[model samples]
Target chain A: MASRAAVKTVIMVAAVALAAATGLAGAGARAADADAVRRGEYLFNAAGCLGCHTDEKGGGKPLAGGRALATPFGTFYPPNITPDPEHGIGRWSDADFIRAFREGRAPDGSYLYPAFPYPSYTRMTDRDLLDLKAYLFSREPVAAANRPHDLSMPFSWRFLLAGWQWLYFDTRGPRPDDPAKPPEWNRGRYVVDALGHCGECHTPRTTFGGMEADRYLAGNPKGPNGDKVPNITPQPRFGIGGWTPGDITLLLETGLTPEGDVVGNAMAEVVRNSTSKLTADDRAAVAAYLQSLPPIGPPP
Target chain B: MDSRVVNALAAGSVAAFLYLGFGGLGAAATDGDPAALVKQREQTMKSMGGGLQTIAKFVKGEAGSAADVQAAVAAITEASSKDPAVVFPQGTAIGTADSDAKPELWQNWPKAVEYWNGLKPATAKLTEAANAGDRAQIAQALQGVSKACANCHEDFRQKKQ
Candidate 1:
């Protein structure tokens, strides 16, 4: 091993260089970066962003993409989300970031497919988006090249997404909320129901791409990785309605379920990336908000 | 955790892999060379011993608890069955883990006759424990049996990823 002094010297140099580059960059200065970074990291995993976007678990490098996300239409290669300007999201401006997430548009005004889960992200508030953007910008830029989606013809066309979005997508802002809910609870609801979009997997989907909001999280048998995503709603049978907030919290902190089982799949990646590191309070808030949803069964 | 199921799966998969991937592994112990096959059996026994020893160390003192007993028992039974010829040596009693085999059992092989003589008693002991239905006794017996299995793993088996 290198001497301790050598390691310290390298760390100090890197820290100083980072200070020089991002020291007074005003974007992240609105709030201390640490909180936003923490929240972004949590939401990213909660959103299952890396689970599909990165083939990190099975001997692949983290966030250096190339996982094939299979949809009925075809398989789409989730891009490397590293901060690399050429191939990743490094150069995205705040508006560009918001638009990509909230509007499903790329930096160059191209529309990204809902497969990126922008449908869930669209519910995100401006602050949450900024925080997520802040976290993404703070990361190391990995220079892995991109791969084109192996989509079949017609579905591969970029313009087709525009018409598809018109039918299945909702570009409208999240509904104005009750003032009674505490700010953090509201924030949790926003992230879970919207930007974080836990329901995309937990909730059943319509034959078209839209979610079955009426049923809300009874369970989605068809998950992004093809594993069954169980219900988080208050249904005692097919859902987590039986789980206490602590049960959910433990599940988030560790890959192990309350039943003393740990599964290997998309969820394992999600736990490794996001939820495991979340602050107790944030995870609790998410649990509280989810449990409060109307107790319901999966879509018939 | 349903460690019983996991143990079955682990042992079954290994047996299956050896059977499917290559013919040599699942074949009868008598099929291979006289000396090399004996050495290979010894190696597997040693590795099993080491694995048991490590877990035994963890479960023995402050770290040991009621939770691990069932798992330990299942693991020991699984290992003992897979290679009883090497795992069980001569001169042991029924329902006992090791049954007082020669102290240098690791150093010597008492041949197929001695091997069957040693393992028959241990297997019988395991059968008794299984039938007793006393959870605590079962667990205690398992720990004892597993201690012997660990020694085998340490000496005889190859490490799998």
Candidate 2:
């Protein structure tokens, strides 16, 4: 009887231990998911997702997407990106999310418009894209139907977008690190090129609306809403060459120019939504990357 | 010639003189010429910018004393205290040379007024900070002022073309 009782005690102890171990493993997984969500929130701000997705002027719900983006082609309303299964991306599989950014193809395999800035987002790594998706999914599942784009004729047809994508979209995978450059520079490059998508407005576009890569960051004469985007290259006269890295960081953080004037208009929205939310190190990284660019003179 | 005809000719000459002399002045007085109003507003804005720069210099310890900061804050306060309606009268929207004011300012007049009114508290905080001579508080208060400026400028000011 004593031996049987002792065996029963040993089995009970083993069962309790196994239960605790399983509990700890579950907790660890939850913590990792939480961490990914946090990282994704930061990436969302960096990518300026909220500004385009939320119609603050019209009192639209955040990420529910009724905001109208006026383009030369026509007005494009960004779709709902929240986690609602019916209207948002809640039903999207991980592969679907990755494909949207990587190939600019929807789950239905329809071509996304270039106005989505996928050209820049396509430079994001699969991991970063997934992290962003994780963050987006964590938001409240808002239930708002997406407003359709108001394009005319050929531009409205999704089939034409395939031709547009073929002409302009670079099929290159995530931007690789340069062995020669420091890690900080590479990180800066990622934030500026991949997440910020600054060139989508700052770079001049061709007649067909594809970005002019040769004149990168040279400033667009006719940007969104007919605003003239300024040159951000390191040119002494035309660009930000006179600005120090600290100046750039300060501008990103506060929208205050070195000359003591605060920036206004659309760039102010960028500063408020995106750059201001970046970590101090990331802001400095943006400055470093911008200052290192080859300065291009004004278009002739 | 008859005396009546001579009097009639004299009245006509006087009327022509008055029209030539005060016609432009009368029009300016009533509706505020768009060009002149834009030029005046731009100057006022530039002066405000200069005052902020002086305060910024003090905050950075690059130059200027507390007294300079006080004076700068006072100038900014004085300039910003004016009724925005007078400063931004109708017909002073963008398209006037060097005027960055967007037509939205007039279109959304009440919102613009609210944004302009928002500057009051920011300037007040700046004034208090300047008086206290606390560098940290002054810098923080200055940020509030910048934000106030940006709030209106974001919707009402056009970017450099």
Which run of 10 residues does model 1 chain B get worst, by summed lDDT?
B152-161
lDDT of 2 by residue, B54-160 (tens): 87767656689989999999988988998998789887777886788888899999999999898899999999999999998998898788888989878989867
TM-score of each: 0.58, 0.88
Candidate 2 residue-wise lDDT, A276-300, digit = tens: 8999899988888898889999987
Residue A31 of model 1, lDDT score: 60
Give one digit per residue, the lDDT tens place, for model 1 in A241-270. 777676676566554344433333455545
Candidate 2 lDDT score at position A36: 89
Which ten residues in a row are the worst by lDDT in model 2 chain B?
B24-33
**Taking chain A by itself, what TM-score does each prediction score?**
0.79, 0.95
Candidate 1: CAPRI quality band: incorrect
